[model samples]
Target: MAENHEHGKMDITEQEKTFEGFVKASIWVAGVAIGILVFLAIFNS
Candidate 1:
């Protein structure tokens, strides 16, 4: 039997690993989506 070893390398940064960063990102995405929707609604009519 062979023992498995971990690579121990992280693909993501430490700043993006925090809950605060996640919430901030979610809010930013939501705001952008809402702005797009509003623009489409106003221009489509």
Candidate 2:
């Protein structure tokens, strides 16, 4: 286990970017879904 112990030495730029993008996409999708639901509710009466 000592041979693979790289504490605080791993390069994670790509991973960080991917995670940021994923979070942004999730927020956008959730917002769009809520907007669509609201539109339907307000118009389907």
Candidate 3:
């Protein structure tokens, strides 16, 4: 098999954007989950 190995020649803008979006979404989800847990703990006592 012929191998074409080029370093830093590939377009990664889309991948970077997708990863940024994933990180943002993960942080938001975690914050919301923690907020819900705090609310439940405070009100359920």
Q: How many Å off is the CA of 9 in candidate 3?
A: 0.7
Each candidate's lDDT (Cα)?
0.82, 0.98, 0.95
Candidate 2 per-residue lDDT over residues 1-45, each given as its tens digit: 799978899899999999999999999999999999999999999
Candidate 3 clash figure, as a count = 0
Which segments of model 2 are wrong by more than 4 Å? 1-4
- Number of clashing pairs, model 1? 0
* Model 2, TM vs. native: 0.88
Clashing pairs in 2: none
The local distance difference test score of model 1 is 0.82
TM-score of each: 0.61, 0.88, 0.88
Which is superior by lDDT, 1 or 2? 2
lDDT for each residue of candidate 3 in 1-45, tens digit (9 for 90 to 100)? 237858788899999999999999999999999999999999998
* lDDT for each residue of candidate 1 in 1-45, tens digit (9 for 90 to 100): 224644655455675668778998999999999999999999999
Which pairs of residues have clashing backbones in candidate 3? none
Off by over 4 Å in 1: 1-17
Q: Residue 15 deviation, candidate 3, in Å? A: 0.3
